[model samples]
Structure formats: C-alpha cells, structure tokens
Target: MQQVKAVVARAKGQPVEVTTINVPDPGPGEAVVKIQACGVCHTDLHYREGGINADFPFLLGHEASGVVEAVGDDVTSVAPGDFVVLNWRAVCGQCRACERGEPQYCFATHNATQKMTLAEGDDAGTELSPALGIGAFAEKTLVAAGQCTKVDPSARPAAVGLLGCGVMAGIGAAINTGAVGRGRSVAVIGCGGVGVAAIAGSALAGASPIIAVDIDAGKLETAKALGATHTVDSSTTDPVEAIKEICAQTYAGAEGADVVIEAVGRPETWKQAFYARDLAGTVVLVGVPTPDMTVPELPLIDVFGRGGALKSSWYGDCLPSRDFPMLVDLYQQGRLDLDAFVTEEIGIDDVEAAFAKMHDGGVLRSVVIL
Candidate 1:
C-alpha cells in the first residue's frame, strides 16, 4: 500500500477534504499511476453536487495526465515510466457493442478492481469510490490498464488531459458522431470548451463558414480564435436568424447552418440547434443536462420535416485508444490549440473555488497540477 494525498468529496455539497489515503498496488488488469496533472471540468462539479449520481465520498477528478508507476500481473498495454492520459472508457472487447464493431458504445468499461481506502486509524477504514472510476485528484490513482492511453511524452498535461473529456466530446461530435466533413457549414452553440473544440474539429475537417454562437462575447472571441469564421451573440441577436444570414444558400436556406451542434445543454439551446441547421443536416448534442431538466417539446412534424439526425454524444463518441494519441499529435503539430483551453493551472484544493468560477464565464478550464 502507498500513502497518498488526494482530494476527497466526503459528502455531497461539502468542500472536498484533502487527506491521506491508502492506495494499494495494482491487482490483475489494474495499473497504478503517479498523476502529474488533471483538468477540472464541469462533470467533476456535477459529481460533487450529486447531479451525476449518489456515489458518496467520491474520489473526485478525472481528465488527467500521469505516468505509469506500476503494472498488475496481467497488464500489458502500459509499463512503468510511460506517459499516459487516463480515460474513463476502457472498452471491453467481449461486449456486444464491441463485437458489433462499435466500441464507443462498449457495454463493459473497466475500472479499478482493488479499493483505495480512506484509513481512519486501524479498524475504521472507509472505501473511496473513484469518480468515473478515475479519481485523478490524488497524487496516485489506480485504474485499469485499458484506461491508460499512451501519448507523446512531451505533450503538456494541462492541455492534453482536456482530450480525455470535453474537447474529445466536441471534436468527436463533429467528426465521429455528426460525421461532419469537407465544405460543411457547421454552427456550434455555446462557445465554451466543447463548442470551441467543435469549431476546431470542423476546421480540421476542412469545413467552411464555421459559425459560433454564444451569449458571452469573450467566449465568442475565443471561439473565433480556435476556428469559427462567424460569431453570433445569442443574447444580442436571434441565432437562428443570424445563422440563416451567415450561411446563406441559393435556396431558402431558411434552415441556416448545415450542421448545428448544441453544446449548451438546455431546452432553449437544443431548440436552437434543432432549427438552426439546414434540412437533413445533422444535429449533435454534446452538452450535459441535469436530472430536473428535460428537452422542450417540439412539433412532431418538425422532427420528420427536418429530415436529419439528432444525436447525443457521450465523451465525443470517443474510443480513447484511437482518439487520444491522434489528438496529441495534432496539438503537437499546432493544428489544435489545446493550451487555449487551459485558463489556469491550480492545485487540487482550489476545485471548490473553481466550481464557483465556472459560472463566472471567464475561464475555459482550470487544471489541477498535482
């Protein structure tokens, strides 16, 4: 066992307590990683708020970058001293989804088998539940070897780690899920981390007239810097009308954008994405919504009349083994500006404060440098 300091959410709606925990060595297919940096994302906040689930004393923090410290008896994917990104989707090849050749929908994803405990003296040991089975808020985390996606060693943890979640979600929404391609006019509504990443993905795929929509002016500016060729301030103007004007076609083009991505997970924004795109254009919803929330009702004819696909992207429909390293290479080549996603590098203790800043509408991402 190894004594490690980790950020522990002892209960829902409480400040995470930084305390020492006992992390046992990897067993079977698991591997122990010495975390160097982890990205603070909205999902982590959701986990802490119990919006995601009722898993208590959650060992919070995922979207992390680290080095393999040790391997279990059956481990083969990674070895000690290898730099890797920790991904939640550790696809099981035997699953029906994998057998059907869609590992992205893998029915069985692996996690740590051995428990990491919060030891209170000798007899009072409390087992900690790793957030998304990753809990990278600690100096060390135990995960399945399949969770470790090896990447270029030189990639910055603060930047590359973002690929583990939001960035991957947005990019994959366009590339993998939406199947966006050359010359397509895509509009992303939200202009946050995921939206901007969608813009980047559209640009990467040689898309044109990539429109960015958001209420925040600053985020729109950032979106343009990433790849958006046009900006629509949803608060200032009706995005549907603006997109119709932006991606004007010879036809009514009343439908406006070709591919509309709802990065803002609200009933209103989903409506915008539903209507903003051209007929038969794809709409991908990457934003996460709360339990109390529900998609607004729309006309049934509109659904059939739209003639396009409406899809939800979980982790960008990403298969970590394929996307992580590929994205790292693009970032290294300066094709993807990952560093722009990281607004600041903070300590794990600052996560609670970071959550408060999330609504501040300033920072894109606050990474925790362990």
Candidate 2:
C-alpha cells in the first residue's frame, strides 16, 4: 500500500478535504495509475452532495488521464509507463453483451476488487466509495486493468482527460447514440460542456444546420465556434420554433432537426427535444436527471405517432478501448478541439474553488493537475 494526497468528501454538503489515503497495490486484474490530470465533473459534485447515494467519505473525481504505474500479474491490456485515460465501464468480456460483440453495453462492468482507505484522521482505515469507481482526484489511484485505455502519449493530458467523461458523453451522444452523420440536421439543447461537445461531434460528422440552444449567450457563442451553424437563445426565443425554422430552410418542409439531443436533463428542455425532431427522427437524452424527477407526461398517442426512438445515453454508449485512441488521434490531428473543453488547470487542493466556478458561464471545465 502507498499513501497519497487526494480529495475526499467526508459528509453530505460539506466542503471536500485534501488529505492522505491508502491505495493498495494492484491485485489480480487490477492496475495502479499515477494520475496526471483529472477534470472536475458535475458528477463529482453530485457525489459530494449525496445526490448520487448515501456513500459518504466518497473519493471524488472520475474524468482522468494517467500513466500506468503498476499492474497485477494477470494484467496485459496496459502496462507500466503507458499513457491512459481512466474509464468507469471496465467491460467484462464474458458478459452477454460482450458475447454478442456489443461490449459497449456490457452488463458486468467492474472496478478494482481492493479498496482504497483513509490513511489519516478520525476516519482512518475507512474504505472509500470511489466516484463512478474511479476516484481520480489524487496523485495515484487503483482501478481494474480494463479501466485504463491507452492513448497517444503526445496528447495533452488536461485536454484528453475529459474524454473519460463529459466530452466523450457528448460526442458519443451524437455519434453513437443519436447516429448523427453527414447531412443530418441536429439541434442540441443546453450549451454546457456536454451540449457543446454534441455540437462539435455533429460538426465532425458533417451534420448541417447544427442549431445550438441555450439560455446563456456566452455558451451559445462557444457552441458556434465549436461547430454550431446557428444559435437559439432560448431565453429570448422559442427553441423548438427556431430549430424547426432553421431545419426547414435547409431541408424543405422539414418540421425540425433530424436529431434533437436533450443535454439539460430537465423536463422542459426534454419536452422541447421531444417536439423538435423531424418525423421518425431520434431524441437522445444524455443529461442525467435526479431521482425525484419523473418523466414529463405526454400523450400516449404522441409516443406511438412519433415513430422515432427516445433513448437515454449511458456514458454516451461508448466503448472506451475503441473510442479513446481514435479521439486522441483526432485531437492530435487538430480535427477535434479537445483543448477548448478545458477552461482552466488547477492544483488538486483547489477542487472546491473549481467547483464554485462551475456555475460560471465562461468556464467549461476545470482540470486538476496532480
């Protein structure tokens, strides 16, 4: 075991602490990663707030990139010195989903069998519940070997680390779940990190008339720079009508965009997405809704009449092993502006400050450099 400095949320709605934790050496099928960079994601904040569960003293942070420091005897997919992105979905190849060659939907994803524990304080020796099974806001962390996806070493850790979560979720929402492609008209509701990533993905896929919907004008401007062909200030304009009007102008008689991504995870925005898609078009919900929030009521006849799919995206339905390397290459080629997603780089101790800045419209991501 080794002691390392890490950020921990000891209780619900309490300030996070930077303290020492004990990370066990890799066991069978596990690996130890020396974290280089980790992005501060909203989910980490959710975990800290007890919004995810009652798992207190949670080791927070998940979106991360690192170098393999050690591996168990059975580990082979990655090795010491390899640059990698950490992922929560470490697929079990024996699962039914993997058996059918759809490991992205693997039913038995896993984490390290061993636990990291609090090394000091009144809570000493208490095992921590890692956020999304990847407690990466630390100098080092232990995870299942499969959680480490090797990528190009030259890629910037601060930029590519985001692929471990939000950026990948957004891109995958469009490219994987929504099946957006060339000539498809796409509209994304919400201009947060994930929403803008959807716009970037749609642009990467050659989607036309990419409409960005947001209440914040600054976020909308960022969306346009990322690939949104048009912008809708939902605070001032009706997004559904604006998206439909834009798509109709490009594709004659079109009622709305071919694909509408609901990234806000709110009832109102989801309703807008539901009604803002063309006939038989898709509605992909990538945003996470709280447990108390129920699906908005709509007519059963509308569901039957829509003739399109309403899907919830789980981690963008991404297979990290396949997608991570490809995305890194794209970033290296300058085709994907992964760097733009990183708003600032901060020390591990500044996590709470970074969390405070999350509501700032100008900040897309605050990355922690270990």
Candidate 3:
C-alpha cells in the first residue's frame, strides 16, 4: 500500500478536502500510475455538489496524464515507465457493444476492483468512490490497466491531460459523432472549453462559417482564437436566428447550419440547437444534463419532419485507444491547439479556488500539477 495526498469530497455540497489516502499495489488487471498532472473538470465540481450521485466522500478529479509505476501480472497493453493519459471508459472487448464492432459504446468498461480508502484521519477506513472511476487528483492513483492510453511523453502533461475528458468530448462530437465535413457550416452553442474545442474540431474538419454562440464576449473571443469564423453573444442576440442568418443557403432558403452542437445542457439551448440546423441537418448534444432536467414538450411530428439525426454524444462517443495518441500527435504537430485550454497550473490544494474560477467562468481549465 502507498499513502498519497488526494482531494476528497466527504459530503454532498461540501468543500473537497486534501487528505491522505491509501493506494494499493496493482492487482490482477490493475495498474498504479504516478500522476503527472490532472486537469480540473466540471464533473469533479458536480460530484462535490451532489449532482452526480449521493456517493459521499467521493475521490474527485479524473482528467489526468501520468507515468505508469506498476501493472498487473497479466497486463500487456501497458507496462511500467509508459507515459499515458488516463481514460474513464476502459473498453471490455467481450461486451455486446464490442461484439457489435462498436467498442466506443462498450457496455462493460473496466475499473480497478480494489478500493482506495482514507489512510489516517476521521474518515479512515472509509472507502471512497473515485470520480468517473479515475480519482486522479493525487500524487498517485490506481486504475484498470486498460484505462491507461500511452502517449508521447514529450507532450505537456497539463495541456494534453484535458483530452482525458472535455477536450476529447468536444473534438469527438464533431469528428466521430457529428461527422463534420469539408465546407459544412457548423454552429456550437456554449463557448466553454468543450464548445471551443468543438469549434477547433469543426475547423480541422474543413468546416466554413463556423459560428460560436455564448453569453460571454471573452469566451466568444477565445472561440475565435480557437477557430470560430463567427460568434454570437446569446445575451444580446437570438442565437438560433443568428445561426440561421450566418449559415443561410440562398438556393433552398435553408437558413440554418449543416450541423448544430448544443454544449450547454439546458432545455432552452437544446431547443435552439433543434431549430438552428438546416433541413435534414444533424444535432449533437454533448453537454451533460442534471437528472431533474427534462426536454421541453415539442411536437412529435416535428421530430419526424425535421428528418435528421438527433444524438446524445456520451463522452463524444470516443474510443480512447484510437483517439488519445492521434490527438497527442496533432498537438505535437501544432495542428490542435491543446495548450490554449490550460488557463493556469496550480497545486492540488488550489482545487477549491479552481472550482470557484470555474463557477465564475474565469478559466478554461486550472490544472493541478503535482
């Protein structure tokens, strides 16, 4: 066993605490990773706010890159000394999804069987639920061997680690889920890290007239820097109408985009995405919604009349094995601006402050550099 400092959310709606936690040696099918850096993601904040579940004393933080310290006896995909990006969805090749040749939708994902517990404190002996099966905001973490996706060690940990979640979600939404193509018009609603990455993806896919919609001008400016051809401040303009005007094709009077991505998880934004796409255009919902939230009532006939795919992109439908290394290569080639996502690097203790900055929309990501 190893004692490491980790961030823990002890109760619903309580502040996360940095404390000692016990990390066990890699058992069969497991691995121990010495975390290099972990990006602070909104999911961690959601876990702390009790939005995800009632699993209290949650071990928060998932988006991470690290060096493999140890591996199980049977592990062959990765070994000690490999630099990897940790992924939550570790595909089990025997699952139905894998048998169907869609490992991206793998039903049986792998996670470490052994639990990490509080080492010594008031909560000692308490088994903690690692956030998204990662619990990476620590000096070291235990995970399934498959969760480790080996990448170029030359890449900056703080920048590339964002691919462990948000960045990958955004890029995959456009490339894998939406299948954005050359000359297609794309609009991404919400200008946060995920949304901006979608803009970058659209750009990489050769999209034109890429429109970014957000309430914050600062975020819109960031989106432009990332690759948005146009931006709409939703606070001052009707986003649906703006997108319609921007993507209008005079031939058929199709006043909407070829693809519209809703990155804000709300009924209002979803409705905008629904109405902002061209005839037979796709709408990809990559944003996470609260359990209490529901889709607003819309005409059922309209759904059929729209005649296009309406899909929810879970983790952007990404297969980590195929995506992680490719994106790292793109980043190294200076094609994908992954570094733009890192607003600052901080110590583990500054997570609470990072959460505050995230709440206020002050930073794209505050990385915890251990």
* TM-scores of the candidates in the order shown: 0.97, 0.99, 0.98
- Model 3 scores a TM of 0.98
Error (Å) of candidate 3 at residue 58 is: 0.8
Cα shift from native, residue 311, model 3 (Å): 0.4
Best by lDDT: 2
lDDT of 2 at 175: 99
Off by over 4 Å in 1: 121-124, 249-254
Best by TM-score: 2
Prediction 2 global C-alpha lDDT: 0.95
The count of residue-pair clashes in candidate 2 stands at 0
Report every candidate's CA lDDT: 0.89, 0.95, 0.93
lDDT of 1 by residue, 18-94 (tens): 88888899999999999998988888888888888886878888989999999998888999999999999999999
Model 2 Cα lDDT, one tens digit per residue, 46-153: 999999999788999999999999999999899999999999999999989999999999999989999999999887999999999999999999999999999999
Per-residue lDDT of candidate 3, residues 144-234 (tens digit): 9999999999999999999999999999999899999897889999989899989999998899889999999999999999999899999
Candidate 3 residue pairs in clash (backbone atoms < 3 Å): none
